[model samples]
Target: MWRQVALEAFPDAGIREPIGASALAEAELRLGRSLPTELKQLLLESNGVIGRTHVDTVWTVDQIVEQNLFFWSDESLARLYMSFDAFLFFGDNGGGDQFAFVQKPERADVFVWEHESDSRRWVANDLRDYLGRSLSAGGDDWYQ
Candidate 1:
C-alpha cells in the first residue's frame, strides 16, 4: 500500500528492497524505542526511497539510527541541536535538517527538525500523511 502510494504520488522515486525484521529490531534496540507502525509498514514494502524534491531520501532503518546518533552526538553542530531521546530520526533533507517520528508519550506525530533554526514543527499526523504531503508536493514549496 505504501509502495503504491509512493509510486503513484512520485513516479520517479528510487525505491530499495525491504529490510529484514532483525535489522528493524536492532535499530529499535539501538534507539531504545519502537518504530512507528506506518513507518515499519512502509519499510517492509521498501527499505527507503530517494529522489524527492525537498527530502533527498527516506533513509533505511539502519541509517535512521546512525544519522540520529551522528546529530545527537555532534558537538560541533549548533548548541540548538536536539537530543535523540525525544525523537526517532528517520529521514534527511540532504541538508542538515532531519525528519523524525515524535517520540513523546502523548504524541506520535511526524516533525521536521530544521537545521538552521534548530527547531521542530509538526508536519504530519503520521508516516502516511507525511508521505502523501511530501510526495504530492510539486516542488520545494513543501519546505516553506
Candidate 2:
C-alpha cells in the first residue's frame, strides 16, 4: 500500500529500503517517542521511505523537527507529506486531535474528504487506506 501511494502520488519518487534497527533506535532517540511496534516492523520489512530523487525530503521525526516541520511529524501528517504537494501544521486540539500545518489550507481541507472519519481515525489503518485510495484513484495510469 505504501509503495502504491508513493508511485501514485509522486510517480517519479524513489523508494528507500528499510533502515536497520540501530538507525531506527537512533531515530527514536531523536524523536522522543517509541515508534509503535507495528509501525517499526512495517518499516523494517518494506521500502518504507518514499521521496522524489530531485527533492530534499526527510523521514525521521528529528529531521522533521530540525527542519521545523514537526507539524508534519505525526503518522497522519507524514501521509500528507508523502501524498500532497505542500502542508503546514495547524494548532493542536486537545484530546489528541492535531491537524497538519499546511502551506495551502485548501489542500489540507481535503484530508477528511479523501479519507473518511474512520479512515483517518487510526494510524496504521488510515495509512493503508490512504495509500490504497491514492493508487486506486490514479488507476492504471499510475502503474506504468
Off by over 4 Å in 2: 1-13, 46-69, 72-124, 139-144
lDDT tens string, model 2, 60-139?
A: 33333343334434567566544422432221112233223233433213132122232322211334443343333433
TM-scores of the candidates are 0.86, 0.39
Give lDDT tens digits, candidate 1, residues 1-144.
978877777888778899888888898898767888888888888998775763555788878878777766777653555565677788766767778887766365888888777788888787777777777777633755
Give me the overall lDDT of model 2: 0.39
Q: Relative to the true structure, how large is the alpha-carbon lDDT of every model?
A: 0.75, 0.39
Predict model 1's lDDT versus the native: 0.75
* TM-score for predicted model 1 compared with the true structure: 0.86
List of clashing residue pairs for candidate 1: none
Candidate 1's error at 49, in angstroms?
A: 1.5
Model 1 spans with C-alpha error above 4 angstroms: 53-55
Clashing pairs in 2: 87-102, 88-101, 88-102, 89-100, 89-101, 90-100, 90-101
